[model samples]
Target: MALAVRQACIRAVIDGYQQAAISGLCPEGAFEAAVDAVRMLDMAAVLQREETAACAAGTENIRREPGSVR
Candidate 1:
C-alpha cells in the first residue's frame, strides 16, 4: 500500500512536470525539487508506518502480559 502511494506520488510529479514544461512555465530546478519533495514524503510515510506498527505491537504485548495495565 505504501509502495502504491509512493508510485502514485512520483507519477503525479512527473505528469505535473511534463505539463509545466509544455506550457513553458516550469522554472529551472523545479523538477528536481519536486522529486526531492516526493522522496521526503515517501520517507515520512515509511517512518509513520514503522511507528504505528511499533505502537500496535507494544499495545498487543501489554494486553498479553499478566497484570499489564494500559
Candidate 2:
C-alpha cells in the first residue's frame, strides 16, 4: 500500500509537471493534489471490492479476513 501510494504521488507529480510545462502554469501543489485525488480513487476501488466480497461471503456463511477480502 505504501509503495502504491508513493508511486501514485510520483505519477501525479510528473503529470502536474507536464501539464504546467505545457500550459505555462506553476506546478506547485498540483502534483500533490493530483496524487491525493488518485489515491482516493484507488481507496474507493479497494473499499468497493471489500464490500462486494463481504456481501458474498456473508451470503455463504463465510467470513473474509481483511487482507484476504479482496
Candidate 3:
C-alpha cells in the first residue's frame, strides 16, 4: 500500500516535471533534478511511516506476550 502510494507520487512528480519542461520554464537538468528530489522525499516519508508502524507493532507485541508482566 505504501509502495503504491510512493509509486503514484513518483509518477505525479514526473508528470509535473514534463509539464514544466514543455513550458520551457525549467532550465536544462532542472526538471530531472526536481523529479529526483520529489522521489527522494516521497521515499523518505514512506520509510519513516513504515518504521513508525513497525515500532508500534513491536511494542504492542511485547506488551501482549505471555511472559510480559507489566
Top lDDT prediction, candidate number = 3
* Model 1: per-residue Cα lDDT at residue 35: 66
Per-residue C-alpha lDDT of model 1 across residues 1-70, encoded as one tens digit per residue: 4665666687767866676667675566558655655665655666677678778978776545567656
Cα lDDT tens digits, model 3, 1-70, are 4675666677767776777677676565657755665755666567677788788978877646577677
Clash totals, every prediction: 0, 0, 0
**Greater-lDDT candidate between 1 and 3:** 3
Relative to the true structure, how large is the alpha-carbon lDDT of every model?
Answer: 0.66, 0.61, 0.68
Off by over 4 Å in 2: 26-70
List all candidate RMSDs to the true structure: 6.3, 8.8, 6.1
Off by over 4 Å in 3: 28-70
Per-residue CA lDDT of model 2 for 1-70, tens digit only, reads 4555465556665765676557665565555555555654555555566667678878888667878864
Residue 11 error, candidate 3, Å: 0.2
Superposition error at 51 for model 1 (Å): 22
